[model samples]
Target chain A: SQQGEEDPQALSIQEGENATMNCSYKTSINNLQWYRQNSGRGLVHLILIRSNEREKHSGRLRVTLDTSKKSSSLLITASRAADTASYFCATITSYGKLTFGQGTILTVHP
Target chain B: DVKVTQSSRYLVKRTGEKVFLECVQDMDHENMFWYRQDPGLGLRLIYFSYDVKMKEKGDIPEGYSVSREKKERFSLILESASTNQTSMYLCASRAGRRALWGQPQHFGDGTRLSIL
Candidate 1:
């Protein structure tokens, strides 16, 4: 079963605009992670935010986690055409297993 | 750099034929996993191995079996392939808790299997 659900099944925006995706999970998690997948490519890990951390930033990517709400969000600043890909949020259970969301398809128009 | 390699990028097989998907990791990680990605259902874990010769069934292991005879290699076997089994299969590996630099799972370029 999937542990997280990403809102806004699809999104489109002009280049340089910021994109935000939200995710909500059913159970408690030790950490939450975001990944990006280009067409016909393997998933690449973006960032990881632990339960004790509320927010974290890496390059143009920012991730926020709210343990109380069992939710998380990923923000990509200054998006580029190359950012046109599928984004997924995964939660790491206490047992150390990773559960992924259905994912949101983000399209950045050049 | 950590590298995970899958044997085949694309494979086509007939229904009821036995299928074998192989995965190898260069990092010598302790944990290796197999996942299947479908259109609506994101990525679902099929099986995983924590050490050599140790295998565990994941969420959807009904028609799948896994083998871990060597430390650096893991294999997923389908006793009888079905059309529904056609999907993108991904392999990933990660360092165990004992590693100095605890890293996230590294994935291989998935194998797209078509059971006709």
Candidate 2:
């Protein structure tokens, strides 16, 4: 019973293009966070949007959250070959534990 | 600059053998988590600890166990390694909201374990 699930299992685009990944979760949450993983390494936190916040931005990364729909989307603009990685969305429940989505594999070809 | 460190980058173990994966965080975060990553299945949580000597089971905690004997250390244990258990193990730590507004977690490189 995974609480979060991401759409578009795999995505490919040219460098400098914009990539968008969406995540949907099944329960009430306090916050949602996005992370990026390179190869098989640990995840690097990218951005976090609270349940009360509708959108957030950090550099070229933009994240939008629709708590009413229990969904979120991450947009990476000006994608680079280095941006090729697995992206995951994690939901933090009121109980304090995080449930992660399966993840979306994004490949930015040079 | 929070630093989370894993003991090994890669590990190999024979089936039925015991395995231990260790993680340490320098920021003294109160929450620590252990997860295993596999193809298609993404990352599955094995266990997490909110404080020393406290542990909680995650979604897939069945063949695994965990220990948090110290504030900055968390260890994942496998009683009997199996081929199915071979995957990349990741550790993360986070401080509560008091420190910052939704502080992001810090992750270690990871331990790639292969059970033959």
Candidate 3:
């Protein structure tokens, strides 16, 4: 069974707009990580936030984690056509295994 | 930079044929993982190894087996490939929690396996 579920299965926006993707998990986790995958390509590491952390930033990407809600969100500011890709959230539990969410497909139009 | 390599980028096998997918990580991380990605399913874990010779089943492990004879290499085996088994296979590696430091996993380019 999948432990995490992402909302807005798909999103579309023009370049320079901001995009937000949300993820919700079912179990407690030690940390949460986000990844980006270009179509038919490998996954690229984006960012990770521990349970104790509330927010993190990497370049134009921002991530927020709310353990009380067991949810997290990824924000991509000033999106570009190159930013179009599928985003996924993975939860690492105490047991040391990662459970991934379905993912969100973001399409940035130029 | 950490590098994780998969043996093949594309593979084609007939039904009932045994298939092997190899992954090697250069960083000598303590953990390695195998996952399969589908159109809508995102990525599902097939197997993982925490240490040399130690393996664990992930969320979807049926019809699959793993081997980890070396600290830097992990192998995923398909006992009998089926059409349904065709998908993109991904390999990843991570150091222990302390070294990982809440960082995302490093992934291989992936193998596109087609079971006919």
Task: Name the lDDT value of residue A21 in candidate 1.
Answer: 99
Q: What is the Cα-based lDDT of residue B26 in candidate 2?
A: 96
For model 1, how does the per-residue alpha-carbon lDDT over B3-96 read when each residue is reduced to its tens digit?
9999999999999999999999999888899999999999999998888999888899999999999989999999999999999999999886
Query: What docking tier does model 1 reach?
Result: medium
TM-score, model 3 to reference? 0.95
Provide C-alpha RMSD values for all models, in order: 1.5, 1.7, 1.5
lDDT by residue (A10-76, candidate 3, tens digit) is 9999999999999999988888989999988889889988899999999999999999999999999
TM-score of chain A of 1: 0.96
Between candidates 1 and 3, the one scoring higher on DockQ is: 3
Q: Per-residue lDDT for B1-116 in model 3, tens only?
A: 89999999999999999999999999978889999999878799999888899998888999999999999999999999889999999999988556563456789999999999
Task: List chain A TM-scores, every candidate, in order.
Answer: 0.96, 0.97, 0.96
User: In candidate 3, how many Å is residue B18 off?
Assistant: 0.8
Top-DockQ structure, candidate number: 3
TM-score of chain A of 2: 0.97
Q: What 10-residue stretch in candidate 2 chain B is worst by lDDT? A: B96-105
Error of 1 at B63 (Å): 1.1
The parts of candidate 2 lying over 4 Å away from their true place are: B96-102
The best candidate in terms of lDDT? 3
Winner on TM-score (1 vs 3): 1
